[model samples]
Target chain A: MQAYANPTRFNALALTILPWCVGSTVLLFLVGLYYSLVVAPQDYQQGETVRIMFIHVPAAWMAMATYTVMALASAVAIIWRHPLADVAAKTAAPIGACFTFLALVTGSLWGKPMWGTWWVWDARLTSVFVLFLLYLGYIAIWQAIEEPAKAARLAAIVALVGFVNIPIIKYSVDWWNSLHQPASVFRMDGPAIHSSILIPLLIMALAYTMLFLTLHLIAMRTEIMRRRIHNMEQAEVQG
Target chain B: MSFTAPHIGFVLASYGLSALVLVGLTLAIVWQARSTMTRLKDLEGRAAKRRKPAKQVKPQ
Candidate 1:
C-alpha cells in the first residue's frame, strides 16, 4: 500500500490491472444476468416481483461498500498522509452516490409490489437516504472549496464522521421495525436463503464490485492527471 | 423470466432503471478521463517544448 503512495506508481499499477477488471466485470454481469433472469426460481409468495431483488440487493450493498472504501481512504489520508488516499476518497464520491441512488430507486421498485407502497420512513430506508445525502455533501465540499489541501482535510473529516451511518444502514432492519426485510445472506447462523437464489445474487454482487473497481481506477487516473495539470499551471504562473 | 408473468413490469422497470443509471455513470467517468488525459498530454508537451534549449544562431 505504501508503495502506491506515489501517484505515478499507482497510475502505472492501475493501468495494468484495469483491463482485467473491465473484462471480469463484463463476464460476471453476463453470467449473473443469465442466472438471475433464467435460472433462479420465482418466490413462493412474491412471485415475479422477487426478480427485482437481483438488482436491488446488489445496488444496496455497493452503495454501502463504496462509502466504506471512501471512509477508509479518508482515514488513510489523515493517518498516513498517503497522497493517493485523498484522490481515492474524492473520486469515489460520485460512484457511491450513483449506487445509493440506484439502491433507493430499486428498493422502491421492489417495495411497491411487496409492501404495497413505493416508500416508507423506516429505519433501513431512512438510513440509506442519509447515506445518499452524505455522498452529495462530500462531493459538494470538494467543489465548493477552491483549495485542494483544505478540501481534502475537510472532506476527510466529513467522511470519517459520516461513516457511522454505515452500520446503522446495515443493522437498521434489526434495530427497528423496518418495512425492509432482514438479513438473509449474511447471518450468524449462516445464510437463510437457498442456493438457487443465493448463487445468482452473489454473482450480481461480485459484478457490481468489479464495476466499482474498474470505474474507481479510471476516476483515480483522471484525478491524478488533473492534479498534475494544476501543479504545472501553478509552476508556469510562478516562474 | 416469462414476459407474461404477473408483475413483470415492475421487474423490468427496476432492471431498466439500474442499467440506465450505471451505464450513464460509467460513460460519464470514462469520458472525463479521456478529456483529462488529452489536456494533461497537451500541457506536458508544451512544458517540454519550453524546456528545450533554443538553437544557436550563426553570426551573419
Candidate 2:
C-alpha cells in the first residue's frame, strides 16, 4: 500500500495489472453467463424470475463493495495523506453509482414478479436507495469544489460518514419485515441455496469484482493525468 | 432457461436492463480515460517545449 503511494509506481502497477483484469473479466463474464443462464436450473418457487438473481445480486454486491473501497481509500487519504487515495475515491464514485443504479433497477424488475410490486419504501429498498444518493452527493462535491485539496478532504469525509449506510442496507431485510427477501447466499448458515445456483452466483460476483478493479485502475490513471494537466496549465499561466 | 415460461419477461427485463447500464458505464469510463490521456500527453509536450528554450536563454 505504501509502495504504491507514489504516483509513478502506482501508475505502472495499474498498467501492468489492468490487462489481466480485463482478460479475466471477459472470460469470467462469459463463463458465468453460460452457467447462470444456460446450465442453472430455475428455482422451484420463483421459477423463471429467479434468473434475475444472477445479475441483481452481483450488482448489489458490487455497489456495496465499491463504496467500501472508496471509504478505505478516503480514510488513507485523510490519515496518511496518500497521494493516490483521493484519486481512487473520486474515480470510484461514478462506477459505484452506476452499480447502485443497476441494483435498484434490476431489483425492481425482480421484485415486480416476486413481490408483486415495482418498489416499496421498505428498510432494505430504502437503504440501498440512500447508497445511490450518497454516491451522487460524493461526486457532486468533487465537481463543485474548485480546489482539489479541499474537495478531496470534503469528499473523503462524506465517504467515511456514508459508509454507515452499508450495514444498514445489508441487514435491513433481516431486521425488518420487508418486501425484499432475506439473505440466502451469504448467511450464517453458509448459503442456503443448493450448489447448482450458488456456483454461477459466485462466478458472476467474482466477474463483477474484476470488472470494478479494471475500471478503477483506468479511472485512477485518467485522474492522475488530469491532475498533471492542471498543474502544467497553472505553471504555464504563471510563466 | 425457457423464454416462453411465465414471468420470463421479468427475467429478461432484469438481464436486459443490467446489460445496458453496465455497457454504458464501461464505454463512458473508457472514453474519458482515452481522451484525458491524449490531452495530458499534449499538455506535457507543450510544457516540455516551453521549458527547452528557457534553459538555452538562461545560459546565454
Candidate 3:
C-alpha cells in the first residue's frame, strides 16, 4: 500500500490490475446473470418480479459500499496525509453517486411492482436517499471550491459526517415501521434466503464490486495524470 | 424467469435501467481516463521539445 503512494508506481499497478478486473467483471456478470434469470426460483410472493432483486439488491449494496470507500479514503487524506488518498476520495465521489442513483432508480422499479408505488418515504428509502444527496453534496464541494487543499478538506468532512447515514440506511427498516423489507441476506443469525437466490445475489455483488474497482482505478489514474499536466503547465509558465 | 409470470415488465425495467446506467458510467470513466492520459503525454512531448532546443543553444 505504501509503495503505491508514488504516482508512478500506482499508475503501473493500476495498469497491470485493470485488465484482470475487467475480465473478471465480465465473467462474473455473465455467470451471475445466468443464475439470476435462469436458475433462481421465482418468489412465491413476488413471482417473476423477484428477478429484479438480482439488480436492485447489488446496486443498493454497492451504493453504500462505495460511499464507505470514499469516506475511508477521505479519512486517510486527513489523518495520514496519503498523497493518493485525496485523489481516491475525489475520484470515487462521482462513481459512488452514479451507483447510488442507479440503486434508487432500480429500487424504484422494484418497488413499483412489489409495493404498488413508484416511490415511498419509508425509513430505509429515505435514509438511502439522504446518502445519494450526500454524494452529490460531496461532489459539489469539490467543484465549488477553487482551492484544491481546501476542497479536499471540506469534501473529507462531508464524507465523514455523511457516513453516519450509512448505519441509518442499513437499520432503517428495523428501527421503524416501513415499507422496505427487513434484512434477509445480511443478518445477525444468517441469510434466510434460499441458496439458489442467495448465490446469484452474492455473485452479482461481486460483479458490481469488480466494476467499482475497475472504474475507481481508472479514475485515480486519470486524476494523477490531470495533476501532472497542471504541474507541467505551471512549470512552463514559471520557467 | 418467465415472461408469462406476473410483473415481468418491472423485472425487465430494473435490469434494463441497471445495465444502461452501469454501461454509461463505465464508458464515461474510461473516456475521461483516456483523455487525461493523452493530454499528459502531449504536454510531456511539448515540454521535451522545448527542452531540446534550449539544451542545443546552451554551452553544454
Candidate 4:
C-alpha cells in the first residue's frame, strides 16, 4: 500500500489496471442488466415494481461503501500523510455524492409506490439524507478553502466526523419502526428475498461495485494530472 | 415482469433521472481535467521558451 502511495507509482499501477476495470465494468453492467431486467423473476408481492430493487439496492450499497472508502482514505491522509491518500479521498467525493443522490432518488421513487409518499422524515431516510449532506459539505470544503493543504486538512476532519452517520444509516431500519424494509441480504436470518429476485440484486450490486472502481481510477488519474499541472505552474511562476 | 405494474412512471422517472445526473457529472469532470491539463502544458511550454533565450543571452 505504501509503495503505491507514491503518485508516480500509483499512476503507473492505475494505467495498467484501468483498462481491465473499464472492461469489467462494461461486461458486468451488460450481464447484470440483462439478468436483472429479463432473467430475474418478478416478486410475488410487489410484482414488477420489484425491478427497482435491482438498481436501487446496488446504488445504496455503493453509496454506503464509497463513504466508508472515503473515510478510510481520509484517515490515511491524516494519520500517515500518504501522498496519494488525499487525492483518493478528494476524487471519491463526487462519485460517492452521485451514488448517494441516486440512492435517495430511487428510494423515494420506490417509496411513493409502496409507502404512498414521495418523501419521508423516517430514521432510515433521514440518515441517508444526512449522508448526502456530508458528501456535499466535504466537496464544499475543497471549493471554499483557497490553500490545498488547508482544504485537505479540513475536509479530512469533516470526513472522519461524518463517519459516525454510516452506522446509523445501516441500522436505522432495525432501530426504529420505519417504512424502510429491514436488511434481508446481510441479516442473520439469511436473505428473506427469494433466489429469483436475489440473483438480480446481487448482479446489480456487482455492477455498481465495478462501476465505482472504474470511475475511481479515472478520477484518481485526473487528480494526479491536476496536481502535476499545479506544480508545473508554481515552478514556472517561481523561475 | 408485468407491463401493467402500478407506478411504472415513477420507476422510469427514477432511472431516467439517475442516468441523466450520472452522465452529466462524468462529462463535467472529464472536461475539467482535460482543460486543466491543456492550460498547464501551455504554461510550461512558454516558460521553457523564455528560459532558452535567457540562457543564450547569458552566454553572449
| Fnat of each candidate | 0.91, 0.97, 0.99, 0.45
Residue A108, model 4, lDDT:
79
What are the candidates' individual DockQ scores? 0.85, 0.86, 0.89, 0.53
State each model's C-alpha RMSD to the native: 3.7, 3.5, 3.4, 3.7
Q: How high is the lDDT of residue A102 in model 3?
A: 81
What TM-score does candidate 1 get on C-alpha atoms? 0.91
Q: Which ten residues in a row have the lowest lDDT in candidate 2 chain A?
A: A182-191
Sorting all predicted structures by lDDT, with the top scorer first, yields 1, 2, 3, 4
Highest lDDT: give the candidate number.
1
Error of 4 at A29 (Å): 1.1
**For model 2, what is the error of residue B26's alpha carbon versus the real structure, in angstroms, after optimal superposition?**
0.9
Better of 2 and 3 by DockQ: 3
| Evaluation by lDDT, superior candidate among 2 and 4 | 2
User: Which pairs clash in model 2?
Assistant: none
Give me candidate 3's TM-score against the actual structure.
0.91
| TM-score of the second chain for every model | 0.84, 0.82, 0.89, 0.82
lDDT by residue (tens digit), candidate 4, B1-60: 456677778767776887787678768776877787687678778878987987888964
Clashes of each: 0, 0, 0, 0
lDDT of each: 0.88, 0.87, 0.85, 0.80
lDDT tens per residue, model 2, A1-239: 78887888989998889889999999999999999899999788788777788888899889988999999999999999999999999999999999999988988888777767788765666778999999999999999999999999999999998997667665765466445554432211123678988899999999999999998899899999888889888888998
Where in model 2 is the C-alpha error above 4 Å? A165-191, B52-60
What does the lDDT read for residue A61 in candidate 2? Answer: 89
TM-score of chain B of 1: 0.84
TM-score of each: 0.91, 0.90, 0.91, 0.87
